[model samples]
Target: MADSGSEEIAVIGNTDLTPSESENNLKNTMVEKGTNLLKRMEINVAEAEKRTGKNAVNMQETYTVYLIETRPVDAASEGTNPVPDSLWRRYSEFELLRNYLLVAYPFVVVPPLPEKRAEFVWHKLTADNMDPDFVERRRVGLENFLLRVASHQVLSNDKIFYSFLTEENGWKETVFETGFQAKADSRLKALNATFRVKNPDKRFAEMKHYGDELQSVISQLLRVRARAADRLYGVYKVHGNYGRVFSEWSAIEKEMGDGLQSAGHHMDAYAASVDDILEEEEHYADQLKEYLFYADAVRAVCRKHELTQFELEMAAQDLTSKKQQREELATGTVRTFSLKGMTSKLFGQETPEQREAKLKMLETQIEEGEELVKERNTECDEYVKSAWVDIERFKEQKDHDLREALISYAIMQISMCKKGIQVWNNAKECFSKM
Candidate 1:
């Protein structure tokens, strides 16, 4: 399939399955990926700043700005045929956009930004926590937030949303100001008034069913990818250990090969033996180091697998949250607020009829969210399958090299032992004649 779901066969170190596990899983994912429109307003965020920058003589800041790319796309184009326009924005900018939507369309549940986290010791500049990879993943989550909002009916049509999507000016502060206004316009008022979800229970149930399917696929893929990543990490460590060991062993073997070579007959035999062992070991040592170098390639794939799972997991969580939000609107009690930020329950709740209307709008969002999930799942499947091919090829080559190296070393040892026995017998014969 050209555009397929992300999948990989991890049976070697993972769970046992039939021999044709890859084929079977692929077949199953193919079934899950029902025919759905796979394109719309394309949005992507990349080129995240993963390093710290100097501000004043003593101050430093993490430059977490990312390039937000967007363009109109169709099912045929699918975000690639035509290039996208890119602009740089900070995580704060994305947060601003989301908050604005939350206030502007209180009736419409806005897609959320990822949880904003700060670390005192391991901030954005740190390798383990806020490295380039972590920044990149956060950027992807923010992009998904934008894409979800853009697909909504009322949210997509908002002028503020349009500016956020395409505007390149100092729109952030202005958007922040506008959003805090909370001033309702005629159109927003009309949306709130006319919105109604008839038979809310039936539609919520329908969306819940499809939403569950998308969640299952995403979660399963994450679990499988996680297993694969840990395995790849183990592989990297193995190669590195072998690389270090053989690398040191090769040096010692070379020292013996050079120093053990003196000019007498018995010494010549010893020299020859040393040379045989050195040649065998050095060749395989270089092989080990070469594979250790290749381990980088494996590590990169593992990172990509991690990223795929993360992006899909974010998408899945968004859908599930959206479902819950819809359910709350459909049947749950109204959100109540208190004066002076104090706890005081004194208000009339949303009517049963009122909740149903909001549920209708929410149902539309959930349905759209499900479609996006499927499209994402297909792309993820494609990535997982491709990564699997690279991983399997690496394993095969490693296995072959290991087997060949062991055989060559064994033969060298046997030859050296046989020659040593002959030399010992000849020396005894000489001593007896004397």
Candidate 2:
């Protein structure tokens, strides 16, 4: 269970999926390799501690905070490594930093933070926020999240993130002073009020669809894994009963007593092994959850692209309308029906001076609209190019991570099965001796 008073925070969700040949070809022009700042700077969340704090209502409460440690790998002029810096921050602070990253780099697929509350968890893994196991898992997760962001070519460069790491005091103040949340709110309102894209990019559409599929598949996998783990736990625990029954029967037997006792001991050991197996399995499940959360980051990039496209279209439409107005002013003809045309017909033709003034106003407005349209077009192009580059990078990382996770999980399961077989085999030997 998460803390009862855990703050309800909003995070960016949306991810892009798939890569087309065209995008692959453009990768060379997008971002250069070896640009990640973390290539020189190392970041880690090494520890978690429970602390007492005042809640919103002023009552004393306990909360968990993590210690973030950062150090530069690059040697100084004297050839010595930089001294490490550490900061203690609560989980909400991580959320704040991630939220800012999402807003600041809308085109980039921001790496996801670990879950604040456990879902689809195994029966053996306690979801309690203060549980030693849960806290340890979250600590590793937070560290992974930082490493991901620090390794990003763009996100690693954020001054706010640097401040979050080094400037322990007033970091929250710095984040709020950026006014990013207000800007995000305004952007949300605009998106809500805007019309759907008239000409959505085929690639983005495909990516968005793929993101949806990825999330659904991962969610289902996690759910199934949790259920399977629970069943496995029950099976192992139930075998402990067999150990009890056999051990009691051993005392009542004559010649078979020794063999029965040995078999009972094997059963007891087999039953006890599940506690460690399931714990190990939870690590793999957490890996799966990371990608499941990653799906949202993918879609976020796609959503930003849509917004860029939408703005571009709106600007182009405005420019076109302005150009049409200029043409009507020059030629005294209305190609499209409008209120202005009706008003002009009702009031009759204006004086030459009035016409000249209107022409001048239209000309100025048309010039500005054309400029706006050009800027918007450039923005859209740049957003698409940059977005595709990050998406490609993310795809490679995702493939590698998922493959390793799945492979490790399979190996663990195989080891577990072999152990079970060995226990049974030994029990069989004991029976043969009898």
Query: Which of the numbered candidates is closest to the native, going by highest lDDT?
Result: 2
Report the C-alpha lDDT of model 2 over 21-87, residue by residue, as the tens digit.
Answer: 2243223222234355566667888899999989889999999999998877665444787667998
In model 1, where do residues sit more than 4 Å from their true spots?
Answer: 1-41, 50-60, 72-84, 107-109, 115-129, 177-434
Candidate 2, residue 244: Cα displacement in angstroms equals 0.8
Q: What would the per-residue lDDT of candidate 1 be over residues 315-405, giving only the tens digit for each residue?
A: 7778997787775555453344424113223454556686677788788989998987886676556555544553444455556865786
Clashing pairs in 1: 4-378, 5-378, 5-381, 5-382, 6-380, 6-381, 6-382, 196-357, 197-357
Against the true structure, whose TM-score is highest? 2
Q: Against the unseen true structure, what C-alpha lDDT does each candidate score? A: 0.49, 0.79
How many clashing pairs does model 2 include?
9
lDDT, model 1:
0.49
